[model samples]
Target chain A: MSRPIYDRVALIGLGLIASSMAHAMKKWGLAGSVAGHARTAETRAAALEIGFCDEVFETAAEAVKGADLVVLAVPVGAMRAVAEEIGPHLKPGATVTDVGSVKQAVVAAVAPHVPEGVHFVPGHPLAGTEHSGPHSGFATLFQNRWCLLVPANADPEAVARLRALWEGMGSYVDEMDAAHHDLVLAVTSHTPHLIAYTMVGVADHLSRVTESEVIKYSAAGFRDFTRIAASDPTMWRDVFLTNKEATLDILGRFTEELFVLQRAIRMGDGQHLHDYFTRTRAIRRGIIEAGQDTAAPDFGRTKSAGD
Target chain B: MSRPIYDRVALIGLGLIASSMAHAMKKWGLAGSVAGHARTAETRAAALEIGFCDEVFETAAEAVKGADLVVLAVPVGAMRAVAEEIGPHLKPGATVTDVGSVKQAVVAAVAPHVPEGVHFVPGHPLAGTEHSGPHSGFATLFQNRWCLLVPANADPEAVARLRALWEGMGSYVDEMDAAHHDLVLAVTSHTPHLIAYTMVGVADHLSRVTESEVIKYSAAGFRDFTRIAASDPTMWRDVFLTNKEATLDILGRFTEELFVLQRAIRMGDGQHLHDYFTRTRAIRRGIIEAGQDTAAPDFGRTKSAGD
Candidate 1:
């Protein structure tokens, strides 16, 4: 194995992303020691039981003490509180980064609490499964995934160091502005999740009052939405609450476009549907070519909990 | 190898589904002779070049002559025409079936044209890739998938023989009524495809207006929609047209439910979102328990064409 990238690494949240990072660190031997803390005692216990961290602490301050690198992996809405809690305990010359999906709010919330001489770099790894919690993590979760590093300033050395850490975990890191990151993720991640949740929620209600036939034949397309809808409830609630403006803006645009399709369907306009299907097919092909995600079925090699 | 299930098998409207069946038949030695016919002569030549069938015929009637089993694998909308074309040529005791998504319509369309002694068994195998055409087929495609049979009458011998045929191709067969089959598929398959098409269409238009940024940062969630959206355009168009009433009914319900979620998002209702997310999660668990699908990522085992 290569030399440790960091002397000590502290993770502030123990959900899917943070837990997966711990798995990656262990798999790659990237950190000297990995310590973690969660907001609740139960979660801290779960993290300990799952062996996600070398040391599990009850408080964020306890987790950050003497650490050379600190990662904030909580929901975007909780970044400010986590920053304030750990700020005093952070070692001087330590690097601070986050795995929040929305970057701008996270930076705005957590930046003020960074102590002098401690480098604060916000990062978002575009990798996760719909399943959450410490138990839902795997070592290969970040393999070939994209990690966007939104550093507060254009500091070449600090950025390179953070990039090295992620690269060790099998991620390709690219620098981007926090505002643009939020806007881009709003369209890519936020709006998509909202749409998925909305569609599944709608189908559920319809299934309840009607023939329940909606889900019986769910293999059509509603099955996909269910996977998205099944994502961590609290985390998604926080995502929408934090990424409000960008999400709402994109949602408005999506609504206008959906209305056009709905009208076409109502009018039996096959050309419109055909054109839309063809265009969408091209986008999927682009994604497959980009290597951002796999074109294979998500659960093909999945082993169950018992397995 | 096992003995051929039929001495001769005829495939009408040779496309993705029919071509795949031909491949499966050849690999499994399930048919001594396989003949294919499409509406277009070019398709017949292409089928011949790819060797998807042992023989390619110019007319459906000619293709079915002397065949003990005939499969109508055309677009659901074209079933009636194909049924009429091949009905007179069907062998005296031949078993006839279809691979249409909508069963009730196929029953109504084909039942009228079938000869007195021919067994008209409407079937839909829940197996496919997004790829289409004679060239886009593999013998192993139907391994461990479902094939639903909606026989017009409770003829146990005919059903048993058809079940054995699907089993030979590695499918688990379930028998049900034609109308119920259509309704179940509407919820599982049809509604989902419509929404995916609509969402992709929405994203495509959004990308055009936003100048391509929407696609540049497509996250995991939107990426899923793109895959579903990318499904064959003409095949989907035919599906919607043939199953208009069932699709329209489900679409109407889906819209109403979507409105509820939209209202919740606009009002910033976290509780509403949370509860909906929880409910949808249970449905996914149910689907897994029923073995309708795996919890793993879509087709995670098979490498993509690019790979």
Candidate 2:
């Protein structure tokens, strides 16, 4: 195990991201001690029972009191309130970072409350699963994944230290401006999630196709959408609300493209549909080659006995 | 090994489905002998080299001449030509079936060409990977998957024999009418694929987000869309073209639901967004509880060392 990066690392929310961070830090010995706080007493109790944190506090302020590294792991919508509660309690020279999906809104929400000597480096780790909460986290959740940092005018020493911590947790860290990070995530995460939620909702609302039929035959393409659609509802709801402009921007472009394909289907334009599909196929190849995803077919999914 | 379900089985269009079927049949001894045909000589040679079939014919007519069962595994658009070519050469008591995605269109295309004493059962196995071609097939590809048969006006004995063959190859067989099958697939498969392709296209065309950035950041939900979008372009093209009406219907419903959620985001209606997202989560739980998918996180996908 490596030397600890910080004497005390405090996580402000004990959900999947926070729990996973605690586990990864413990696995790598990257922190001297981990402290956690959850809004719900049940979650705090579970985190203690799970034994990922050395200490559990009922208040965010108590959690941040002696920590040199403070991580805001709450939903985007809850970031501001937690920041306000923990601002005065953060150690003078501590480094603060977040695990929010959108960078710009997070920066806007939490940056103002950071103390004069403290550093705030907004970040988003490009990793997750449909499952959520403390039980859903694993030590390898961030393994081989990208963690983008928006270190807008933060001190160089603080930025480097935060980067080292993420690297220790098995992430490849990159620095990007907050606006660009938000826009990129809008295209890559927020918008795709919105589309998936919409498609699954459409299936749910269709009266002619019973729910059982949809679930039974979901292996045919729809199941992939359902996986993403099943992601943490509150987190995703905050994502759309916080990154409104960029999400809407990508959504508009998506609808424009969908309409074109829809018209092609209606007009029986086989050539147009074939060309479009062939172009998209190349993108998947690029992703696999980039080592962002496995090259295995069907994401290397295995069937349960009754599937 | 199980008893042979057919004396000789003919598979036209030796792509993923046909190749997998051949492998499954061979694994279970479901067919005494397998005869295969493909439009290209390279594929026929590959089938022979792969040794899944007893013989590979240059034409469908030659392949089905003495076969007791024939499977049309070509793209939906090519079903008519394949049926027309092999119609006269089919044995008097043969049962002709297909693995096309859309049933109503296949029935319309192949029914007229079927001889009087022969049975035409249109079947679709709800199984596949993003990969295609003869090299992609595996013997266990159909294990625990669903195969729907639209046995319109076919003799009961013929349908039963076909069901037995699919069961031998490790599938649970169900029968549905042609129209309902087409509509159900439209909701569960075709339209979802179209949406995924369109969303990936939107990402590809975005000038602000470089393709490299999109690929690098794909693990944050976009990679799932890319998997389905990367499916065989020729097959999906034919699926949309043939299942036009039902796909269009579902696309309309999808857009309407998307617009509602889009409006909520624009209006900053968090409750609406949260409710919609919460409702869709139930559908995913149903899918997992039905044993259609694994409860493991991320479809139980194991990342490669570099991923």
By lDDT, the best candidate is 2
Chain B, per-candidate TM-score: 0.92, 0.98
Backbone collisions counted per model = 16, 0
Error of 2 at A178 (Å): 0.9
Candidate number of the best TM-score: 2
- Best candidate per DockQ, number? 2
**Full-model lDDT for every candidate:** 0.77, 0.92
* Per-residue lDDT value at A232 in model 1: 83
Cα lDDT tens digits for candidate 2, B1-307 = 7679898999999999999999999988899999999989899999999998899988899999899999999999999999999999999989999999999899999999999999998999999999999888988788878999999779999999999999888888999999999999999999999999998999999999999999999999999999999999999999999999999999999998899999999999999999999999999999998777888888887743565
Model 2 earns a TM-score of: 0.99
Worst 10 residues of 2 chain A by lDDT: A298-307
Inter-residue clash pairs, candidate 2 = none
